[model samples]
Target: MPLFGRKKSEDPSALRWSREPLPPTPEPGPDGLRSMEDHRDYLLSCLTELPPFSQHLLDALDLSICEDVYSAIDMPRFDNSAMDGYAVRAVDVAAASAEHPVSLPVVGEVAAGQDALDRLSPGTAIKIMTGAPLPPAADAIVPYENTDRGASDVRVFAPSVVSQHVRYVGEDIRAGSQLFAAGAQLGPRDVGLLAAIGRDTVLVRPRPRVAVVSTGSELVEPGQELGHAHQIYDSNSTMLAAAAKAAGAQVYRVGLVSDDPESVLQVISDQLVRADLILSTGGVSQGDYDVVKAVLPQLGETDFTAVAMQPGKPQGFGLIGDDRVPMIMLPGNPVSAFVSFEAFVRPAIRKLMGVTPYTRPVVRCRATHDFGSAPGKRQLARGIVSLDADGGRLVELAGGHGSHLLGDLARANAIIVLGEDVTQVATGDDVDVWLLDEVS
Candidate 1:
């Protein structure tokens, strides 16, 4: 069944869908709920990549460039010595050897950064240091090791080859050539290159700022003493914030907000100043305490829908606040929240950062053992994925398939994704998996 309906939301900075009548939603499954694929697509469609900004080279690391960068100056601006050597005429040293060494008057000494070019007279050599500019008429270099370490007169014991140890202008890269193409993310080496090319700044897309909020009446801080038996520490905010950071977004970890409509509204509204995207966990399902679902619709056009997925069925999303920042509501269970992130939030964050292929890389693997899945719902089972003896993919469930199993989710490094129709998988059967380690 189609999970995404026609996009009616409008964002001034984003590419909006057409106002023309859209095709009808796809046919529904027996549960009559939207499919996971459709819901994820809807959230992504509503997002626009963040605008580009000018940032210094060091600050632009890991960010994608928005425009092509061309070299303004040639590398190796002038001919220089590749090593500490005596600049010489190759012919003058052609007969100089240890058995029959030639003697020459050392006219002068040149170190790196010295621009003086005293032309080399025949039968004469200039003592030069590494990276020193070559004299105007010099053609080769005789290393100091081949000549006596003398201050004035020197003895050459080896022959020099023309152009040897000489670094010519534009040897590496010429001026006005393309240094980096648009959309290339800067790495350590790229930063070095940018510096080498005299680029102090670059234009690139900035990382998205994500605000993570957790809502619950019984939630308490991790270190606080529990006021009641039913109270549990709020772990969702920290977990989600770390995940967002790992996904290359700046994260704001908000404190727990009780299940009150006014508090929820106030907290979410205040975050609009810094948040490019808002992610809240809990209170989207059908329950008496579903305050988020009831209060969010008042702030913006929000929807609470049932998705056909095990561990996480209730979902919510919309553009909220006056600035219209995108917000995605996730289930309260830790495992469900994580799976929801893998399916939706991570991709949205990727889209905001202007990266391609938002979804985690999926691979076809064989099951290490049999596992059961809920009928009429797609299941994301926590599991460990690795290569078999033959270098083929293999996966095994980390623990029992339970939504509240945080320990198993912690142990898992991958997700075993079973389609809605798959009820069981026997040993050695093929399976599809999302590699959690490859968020990029």
Candidate 2:
């Protein structure tokens, strides 16, 4: 009803104007706080892209056999002697001992790596060296320590058993048996096994190529003189390269690029052509100088932005070029850069490198002090892990929680993960930790 009004029924249609639809809410990406489990699941689903490679034998790769495999060929290849003494019939030395010695004429001498020429007869013995082929007529080998050697005869003081010290053909390995199964990572002992079985070449998965770059004009090369005003030496490229290599990837450091759109686009284009994965640190935040955030959409569609994690909260992910090589953009701060790499980027690289079950080992520990984290985001706090009184592992926070503190990261052996919904934890509270180093 028009209270100030004049004509209520004259223009009823004019009063019934349609309301415009509100703009659609923006689709969710990696922004907003997320649970640890939710983040882990997202990462697992997204890291399905892996390089294709064939597996090979350990022997071919000069690796060891920590596991047992059935022999494919007869071991010992041939029947041979196992001692450097007299080879005689067991019947001849049945009663021979120190108290009652049996004497026999030596018919011939068989040295190692040589064939036995003469067969032993009754009342006769043949001198045999270790690894020499056993004479057909000899059934046992008596050690030299138990025999008295003479010009043509030897006296045995110890009784000899049948087939004693004789290595039979095929005793170690049988022909046509499976040696090793597929998918076993070759080791030194595996290498010996392959050699023993006569393998020359092995096929292995090709190493994944990872390209790393540092961003920001304020960052200079390590050897270069530092500028007095807000300039720092670049370390993210070197650190990321080393970490990639240690994770079995072939690393390529593209060095530092200024926080400029054209420069970043050119570097990313070049890297995407050669790298299976590209990692760049800096220029991901909302700062005026954040070039990566500005440039990524120009290069390719953004997969996500700003994961719900600390230190690395401003992370970004997307394809690099038309070829669609995966690229991950990390924050510039040293500790943030490293923590992001460990929590997400490392697993992705490992997957591309054909690493199975590509996830870090998580252990339970008791926090030494109370800890606090923002609600709805996962917090990875650096900590030192050690064995407690009951032999259980314990993790204590490493100094400061600031993202720029690289010193704390250096001394940290593990990362204490606080999940979303857990805002505060008391001392001795159970926490989940991922061990950074592989300790026995």
Candidate 3:
């Protein structure tokens, strides 16, 4: 059975299905609801089709390589001195000691980038600065402290070995060697490496451009006077924008819209020209004023489904516009929207940017407090995961499990996941933990 375009019922109390009989308690199962992994795979299947270009030199610092970066020249292209010392023939100072000192005439002085035309022979030395090219016929270096520290003539009291204090050519990196592989995230050091290799810019995957929208008639911008008694602050757009930015995507935040389908559709249409992904929070539930549901399906192949998950069960996803940009619809509640982003949208953005292993780090830990979950529905409850004195991993609920509880979500470092069959979890029971703080 295809679960791709399953339409959810407008009323949960009187559930009805178009193709088959409704199950008890509106519990979506493996056959009815799309699994998290299946949905993620479907979203990632078309990401490779994103166009790549190397013509534009990346002006910003945060970028990732799309292919392996190879070196054009050998590192340390020439043999240079590693210390400020006298470049001399090792044989001249091989037998010199404190009691029987050897003297050598300093023929010339050389600093970094200076020509080393003077040749060093037996009983002669060149006063070489650090990073200076080695003079001809010089085999080793004698430090200034071991000699008289003189510029014209130097006396050596200690024996020196061949190739001492010398930096050989191609010692750090050889020409034609690969510096970094594909999918490697580039930082300042990586950029510097590319510069050292004589490349003005590198081929990198373009950052996924994300457009965030929040919908509701009973919402107003923060710091403004709330004239209506029912109006609350619109925070989902800003929060989702920040989250997308933190995941390495370029974010464009759309202004808040009312519960009108036409207005929401127009805003999404306007953003399709610039965005690679569109994320909207609010108005996708079983309510009459569900703006996202009413607008998204009219534009493209959007599917409004009831997933087997709590707080964010009413979800929607599809491709839209001529470019077929991916769009994710999250529930209206702030906590629910944030949780859905962490679980799905963030990873999708990373995947669009060619990042591998995009999912959050997961760990299994024993629950320190008792918690209850709805029957036959997966639950992702906020929790603070920590290690005890004995190195035992313990997980405790951050606060109440309500979808509107932002205080608990702020304090949570992890999302404790309970299975569909698990109705009640007692203390000491192990649960899978999705490490939210690791990525956010």
- TM-score to native of every candidate shown: 0.84, 0.76, 0.83
Would you list the clashing residue pairs of candidate 1? Answer: none
lDDT of 1 by residue, 1-440 (tens): 11112233233223332233222334556678999999888888778888898999888888878999999998888999997978989999899889999888899989998884678898888999999999978999989889886778889999989998999999998999998998887889999999999989999888898999999999999988999789999888899999999988988999899998888887877776678899999999999998989888766667678899888899998677555678999999999999999899999988887877789877988998887888889899998988867788788999998788899898888999999889889999989898876321
In model 2, where is the ten-residue run with the lowest total lDDT? 1-10
Indicate which candidate wins on lDDT.
Answer: 1
- Cα RMSD to the true fold for all candidates: 6.0, 13.8, 7.2
Clashing pairs in 3: none
lDDT of each: 0.85, 0.74, 0.78
Candidate 2 residue spans exceeding 4 A from truth? 1-31, 34-72, 79-173
Q: List, residue by residue over 134-193, the lDDT tens digit for candidate 2.
A: 888888999898998754989999988998999988887787777776445566767676
| Residue-level error in angstroms, candidate 2, position 293 | 2.0
lDDT measured at residue 77 in model 1 versus the true structure, 0 to 100? 89
Query: Candidate 1, after superposition: displacement of residue 411 in Å?
Result: 2.5
